[model samples]
Target chain A: MTILFEIKKNYELQKVTWKEKDILVNTDCGVKQIRIWKDRALLDWHVRWRDEVGKNSLAVADRMIRTSEGKPWVDMGSEYLTLHDYVEGTHERSGHEKRWGLLIGNMLQAGLELQEEFSSVTKEDHYSFDACLAAIHKLSKEYNELVSVKNSLPEANKRLNLAMELKKASSHVPLPLFDSDTHMNNGGQIFNILFYRGSDDYPEHGYQPLRRLLTEWLKECGPYSLRKLLTCINEHFSLEREQGYLLLAEILTPWELQDCVVQLKNEELAHIVSYVKSFEQDWDFNRILLHCFTDWMDDKRKRVAL
Target chain B: MSHSNETVNYGPILFQYDLYPEKIEEVGKVKKVISRRGTFALKETSLNEEEASWFTHVIHRLSEIGYHQIVPLYPTKYGDYTVQYGNRTYYLMPWFAGGDRFGLTREEAIIEEIGKIHFLTLKEQDFSPEVVDHSFQYLMQRWESRQLEMERFAEESERMPYMSPFELTYLSHFHHMMRMAEDAKRRLKDWYDACHSEKRYRSVLCHGKLSRNHLLYSHHGEPHLLNFEKAVLDTPVRDLAVFFRKAVHLSNWTKEEGGRLLSLYQRHIPLLDEEKSLLVSYISYPEPLFHSVDLYRHQRERYSQIEFVHRLEKRISAMRHIRDFCDLILTPPPPQPLDTNINTDHI
Candidate 1:
């Protein structure tokens, strides 16, 4: 017995061909061959072509036939085909490139299953991937807005804002990919970049372009919306960070630091004050600047005398 | 002796009162007056109303035995149990001519003196069982209630910012100790109930709070026990445990020195293995009981001095060591009677 399975990509659909007692499907991306026997079916697919850009063309072939009882066999959709092809090609290019491809591939497959279960929208519309990407983008924008607003608030309020940013950041961060049943394979370069740069301590100044993108979207959200967003961040994300900050402050400064120390401290708020102090015996250049700033503030207070 | 009631004076009684003597002269003169009171000795510290009543009871009981450790110059019809100053109470007995106060010249002497006190047993004397049971029950109830109050205070301290982490830890440990004490109490009570029906040992007298102040010495260095205020019918080892803690453990006596003292005590009055085991539990529980009281009182005064806080903190830290010692001594591998007899199959 034999059964026909349709392969569709974008607006293109084709009936895969079969060979002697089997069906063979050949496409530009890969070749998939299928065979049927009494009460059993077998199928195999592999990548076979390169695109015009000299990049390996993303492809997948799923051979679908039937057993003697007419049970349908294999169905590898266009998205899985594209993802698998992308992963294989990326692996050939660089070890790091393959990691991100694998991560995204796993996520995409899971997302596809989830979409199939709940979404009335079909894969033809590409709504599932679009929705995920959109959600991540929205979260990034919200985070950027929170960081900016936090800078404007008082020290106490800053904590709430920072927490908001962290929540937004965490939600958008991609889930790690699995290699086999037990182990996770973090895509090399992509994983490193995400862990290092996408971290809470990532250089906010260095990612100005992304930050600007976030800021633009956040401005459209309105001040009230932004505040509400920050409150949500504080409620969810910033609590641990706030606690860590307070603990650091208490341990570092048993007594109030001198004006010189305070002026020097402000320049490197990047790490905790204790962490900075732990680096060297004497205060560094950044700490000196902070100390000077504090001294100046103290002098100004004395002059006002009111 | 023939007594004439016609204008008989009790001698020229020179009463010397020094609330806080400014100079050694004042104390010296007072001492002279006390010496002149014909067979009299100075009692250190003033007594409160409860202590006075307890002292009165002791003197009255001692008079009935015909040997008055308290010497009254003029024996009134009622006897020598009388108030000296409005604040301080004294009982007059026929004092030995050159009897010395039990002065602890060295730390070893203190432990030895404690051992002497523990050796005292009223094994031959008959006491009212009702009185003994009532007094023992009262103290047990007091201790139990105090533990509960300390626990509640600890729970309250958890919410306080000023409460030191050390204090919080101490309170937690203390709660554990209290639980062990409560367990011991239940077990002991069960044993007591069982023993009551069996009538094996009818009653044993205990000097509840055995301290240095309750001891006296004769010119010949013979030790005499005083102040049976908290005396009641319980295991005599309970008195021994209290004496060991208050006079031996609390003092600067070394473990070796304490062992020596214990040996001396055992020579005078032998201890059963169970009695020795129970001693550790008794010693471990009381210090915390006293400490909890102190903490509660300090909190009441709203005193936040570092010294006071540090004392409480130290006690809290010491609790674990005390508990370990208690467990090492009390919780042997042998299965408890209660544990073995309980019908675990049904429950």
Candidate 2:
């Protein structure tokens, strides 16, 4: 609070107090809120978001009021901070979900427009998407090797338990069939390693590159964590329907993220769980997983009947 | 909805209207019937249960509201607005001896009359707010998808060793069309916000296809809106948008000329800032470019390149006019202070 006073700004600070979640400061111009956070990247993302949506009142905060030197934020040695014009209102919590759907519809409409405005932005921000895929492939190989020697190596006991779980989860995905009887073990083959080795249209399955991406996304991505809240607002659909699409996809996957701990870091796992659990109530991910898994179980059911 | 015969047996139709017909003449799609009582024009069109009833209701309502510019002359006989003859729905309207569409004055008068019709059609409805938002969303979705396809096509075409003239044109002007689409979407937001914050959307009885053919001019200096086939209950700005698309194509494509036309229309029916914004958004779309590209892509090798190129050039010229008009509308008004207006008691 004193940092704002010490900044030697244009607007004279009048009254500073806590109004619920925000720290409100009434300046000579108007009331403004000060935002404090730890991560600079998150702060940078916040600044970009504010610039994109601030003017339009779609439940997003308005533009950040620049300091005297025209800087948006002040790196106060330990933490990052910014300022915005305080909007005096409260959320309509009762129908917030429906309201949220409309807000997202608004954002989608806005984003479609913004996409063109942003067309001049040739500098695309690359992500960990491809790297993450490569990491998963490497991890799957390690898990497979550990499982192959579970009986021989005592040190591989903990990893073998995780490998079994990963295998159970991995089998539901029908892919690149093996040519040799030698490769057909009781356990699942390492993902992509065997899959990529097959023909271009491997196993004569209809899975295209986009479908592979989607399957990978469903099996891997939890959600954008914070981006989901903003991006979900852009989805022009009813709350229940979108929530169904998300939960249904999650449920169809065999893994409950318990096996992901050995693969993904603690923060990553937490974020993934945060995304998976964000689905609407009464939607059973396990039941959906069980139902989809029946495709594989149906082969055994007929043989058992025979 | 069904199609009737080329020749209409006027006996049953006259019986319904309770008139005696001596002569009947087929001018175009409509047949002019001269009776002892009066002259009437009957035309058959396809409409389902709801559409027929709604169109009939809107046209009749306009006459009921004392709008004389439009002749909603559906004979209210036998408790029906339409007569089923030869498995087709038919409408019999009072026929007028219309002359050739002459000058700009006549065209301007007709447009002004349409603006009046739009004003008369407004009603307070809550659903309109939602409809505007939804329609805006739907339009954006379509534009976004189209732009994405164009991008994919461009990337693929760029890598090719040889490219056709159409492909060359598409690649060259891709960004401009896309930018226009973006502008349209942005202006749409402005319109949406205005209507949303005001809690009122201007829904009107729009003559969806307004053209010189649809406007019948008489020797006695009187004009009447004839066709009701494509009339719909939508935002009032739609009629203005359609009119401007046609008008600018017919006239010099300039902002001054366009503004004068709007002024002429505003004289008959004053446009709200929101409606003006909505109209700007509507016309900002590169409809001409969309159609030309569509034709080129669909026809591909069969279509003549030079002919298509000429057509594309003409459409692009017209599109440039539309873009210029949008610029006039979108010139940012001086910054307005944040409206502190709020229902304090409710808050």
Residue A215 in model 1: shift from native, Å? Answer: 99
Q: State every prediction's TM-score relative to the real structure.
A: 0.36, 0.46
**TM-score quality measure for candidate 2:** 0.46
Q: Write the per-residue lDDT of candidate 2 for residues B248-286, one digit (tens) a residue.
A: 777645777887787777776677788778888888777
Predicted candidate 1 versus true structure: per-residue lDDT over A1-306, tens digit per residue: 223343333203243333322334543333433333221110111111011101111211111212222223333332121211111111122222232233323222333223323232121111132333343344335334223222222432333344345434554332211111111121112112211011111111111222222122233443333233323323322313332233222222211112222333344444334432433322232233233323433544575676
- For model 2, the stretches where C-alpha displacement exceeds 4 angstroms are A1-306, B1-5, B8-28, B32-39, B74-79, B99-104, B127-132, B152-162, B299-303, B331-347
Q: Report chain A TM-scores, every model.
A: 0.18, 0.35
Local distance difference test scores for all models? 0.38, 0.55
Best candidate, TM-score: 2
Candidate 1 local lDDT, B39-61, one digit each (tens): 34333336665675566665455
